[model samples]
Structures are given as structure tokens and as C-alpha cells.
Target: MIGIVYITAGSMENASEIARELVVRRLAACVNMFPTFSIYRWEEKVEEQNEIVLLVKTDSSRLDEIIGTVKHLHTYSLPAIEFWEVKGEEEYLDWVHVNSS
Candidate 1:
């Protein structure tokens, strides 16, 4: 089965760098970027910020490696990294699994 991971980079440059590495290392089949506005509580204070959201596509087998790679390249002490299993059509999941390699 395949899955989709969501991660946010500290900046555009970092996002691009990580995306390239993921693809080169065969950790992800694709990485998409979109403008994002986030509002959340940090350090007991609510803050709003503009950021770039990365939609990462890869097989489940590569999940841990991909996460580790992101953590290593990420700037924040704690980066926003989350994954959601792809409960989609069979064909699509297979495609993700195939291309991720």
C-alpha cells in the first residue's frame, strides 16, 4: 500500500532542497508545494504564520526513511511531519507504490 505524507518546511529554499533529496534518494515519488496559512498555539500562545505545505507521495515501506531524511534536513527543532494512509482507489495506490521507488 502507498501513503501520503504532509510536511512543512521553514522556508521555500529548504522545501526545495528536501524535495530534491527525497526524489534523488528514492524516498518519494513526488513532492508538491502549496501556499499555506497556519494558526496554532505554540509556547502557550496562538500565532498565525504563512508557510509552504509539502505533499509527499511515497510507498509505506519508505515512510521511516523519508521522515528521518526530513528531520535531518529540517531547520526547526520540531518540524511538522504527518502522514495519512491513502485510502483511495486501488489503481492510484498502486501507482504511488510503483513510482515511489
Candidate 2:
């Protein structure tokens, strides 16, 4: 199966660094990052901030390693990380599995 991991970072540099690490370690096949704004409750107060989002594509088998690497490399004390199984083109999914492996 395929998996997509969603993560948010404080800055473009941070996001890029995390993406690079994941790709280099073969934990992710590819990472797409973009700037976004987030509004959420933290410390019992609503907070809004500009952030970078990373969309990580990989094989489901690598999900645990991806999460561990992100936690080790992420700057935030509590980074936003989520993952879900997905379906996609067969060829593309095969490529993801090959690269992640």
C-alpha cells in the first residue's frame, strides 16, 4: 500500500531540511513542500502563524521510520504529523515503493 505523511514546519528552511533528510534516508520517495497559514489552539490560546507544509509520499512499510526521523529532526516540540493510506496510479505507486525501499 501507499502512504502520505503530512507535516508542518516553522519555516521554508526547516521544511526543506526535513524533506532532504527523509529523501536521503529512503524514508520517503518524494516530498512536496509549500507555504501555508495555520490557526490552532496551543497553550489554551488560539494562535495563527505562517508555516510550510510537507507532503511526503512513500511505501507504507516506511511509515514508522518516517515518523521517527521527523520527530528527531523537527524543530517544534510538538510537530504536526499525520499519515493516511492512499490509492494512486499503479506505476507511480510502484515507483514510490522502489525508491523508498
Number of the top candidate by TM-score? 2
Superposition error at 1 for model 1 (Å): 1.9
Please estimate how well model 2 matches the true structure, expressed as its whole-model Cα lDDT: 0.92
Candidate 2 backbone collisions, by pair: none
Score residue 99 of candidate 2 by CA lDDT: 94
TM-scores for the candidates: 0.90, 0.96
Q: RMSD in angstroms, candidate 1? A: 1.4
Evaluate residue 69 in candidate 2 and report its C-alpha lDDT on the 0 to 100 scale: 92
Q: Judge candidate 1 against the unseen true structure and give its global Cα lDDT, from 0 to 1.
A: 0.86
Candidate 1's residue-wise lDDT over 1-101, tens digit each? 57788998768998898889998898888999988888988899998888888999998889889989999998877888888887888887777778787
Q: How many steric overlaps does candidate 1 have?
A: 0
